[model samples]
Target: MNLRQKIATGAITLCSSTLVLFLGTWEGNGQNTVYADKLARGLPTVCKGITKHTSPDPVVVGDYWSDERCAEVEHLVIEKGQLALADCLTNQAIEQNTFDALTSHGHNFGMPSTCASRAVGLINAGRIADGCRALAKAPDGSPVWSYVTDAQGKKKFVPGLYARRLKEAELCAK
Candidate 1:
């Protein structure tokens, strides 16, 4: 075969080999029809459990935790009619620079902007509001602040403002 044809053949063979191996492994067990379920749920499974070898970003334990934390709070507000998510997230904001830290850690989705927006959307769409208002305030009576200070010592807290997605949306509407 020509060089190009040989390369194509090799690529196809490698992909099929990987697929066959995956089909025989834990994820591919006949229990849930893994491939079918992935397709149905819109879950990405092109690389299965394989990491950098295939997809550049592989889901990790930390990713799951972030998702779980967010989901748990959302669920509590939406399903249980509980306001604890606000308190839980209040502590989360103060203890962790959650939004910025998550962004710096290459976790864009974990940022409060996105999560807060989603939470609010859920609330507006018949789910509970989840009390994101409380999250924007620091425990020490100061608001959760964000802004750039000028060299002249001008501090701006954008008073009564929220750096959250849902709150931003709400404000924008008004």
Candidate 2:
């Protein structure tokens, strides 16, 4: 209509366009969106390329965080394939390592007597990550488990149950 009104409208349009472009490019950058769905609130955000270990979230059930970067590492395992990733994820339990939480569960549940078989059957064949991603994030938009953040940050587990699983996967190349 008027010159002033037209100019203001044009300015608004330009600003909106720029904002949309900036946000699109910034999406998922330096962030781990793979497990964003599994992240918990009050915990840190999972980025794509910045794994750091500096959060207060504890690993628990419904926690994608295992004090081990299972989620992040899982991607590699998955890309490698089901059978191989299963071997990697369950290596600790198979060895009867006390650190593997799954081992205890496996012994009690009688899934397969060996953690490796159980892991392979459940994760590779059954697709545990698919299920986990749905329920791992917090209500406040943070990670449920601290490990997811750590995984996103590229932190590895020490030489223990979790570490063993990851190491096994890395060694297996699957």
Candidate 3:
């Protein structure tokens, strides 16, 4: 289901396609089919970024998860990530797009890292738009997180990540 579709999960209202679609589209949106990661983190992933490590059931490279299972797992994982991200936020009541964008960013990055990010710090300081922009670039014209270690133990600039951060920043600014 896309973001246009809403389904109830446990207690999280994360069924909106806005967040799900934003994340799912970037996740290289899949259903039951398990495949390799698009980036260098070669984990076997399924559904909307549900890796074998994140799922309740053991997932191998060739695993075939059910759609119901994928949705359930994705919702649960997203809910957990969002909740964790929310806790790191400040007194500001964030907008839906802000929440979605930050949540997705936290999901891709780590919530702990997101919590300690300059973006979160700016958001805490009531600089929402500035905070959103911080995710894409620092004041010195550099990305906050556009590098990933390659198999050769070298940092590689992931254009996809940089693009996604810009998109997230755009969503947040709106």
lDDT order of candidates, top first: 3, 2, 1
In model 1, the number of clashes is 0
Q: How close is candidate 2 to the true structure, as a TM-score?
A: 0.18
**TM-score for each candidate, following the candidate numbering:** 0.20, 0.18, 0.86
RMSD of 3: 5.3
The best candidate by lDDT is 3
lDDT of 2 by residue, 48-120 (tens): 2112222223323233333246334423322222222233453222221221223222222222333334334
Model 1 alpha-carbon drift over 4 Å, by segment? 1-135, 159-174
Q: Tens digits of per-residue lDDT for model 1 on 1-174?
A: 432233344421212332223223422322211122221223333212222222334423323323334333323222221121222232221211222221211111223453354333443343332323323333354455333354465765543223432233232222
What C-alpha lDDT, on a 0 to 100 scale, does residue 34 get in candidate 2?
A: 27
Regions of candidate 2 where Cα sits further than 4 Å from its true position: 1-27, 30-38, 49-86, 89-119, 122-174
Most accurate candidate by TM-score? 3
Query: Candidate 3 overall Cα lDDT vs. reference?
Result: 0.76
lDDT at 126 for candidate 1? 38
TM-score, predicted candidate 1 vs. hidden true structure? 0.20
Q: Write the per-residue lDDT of candidate 3 for residues 44-123, one digit (tens) a residue.
A: 87887777555677767777887788888888888777777766776354666777888878777777988898988998
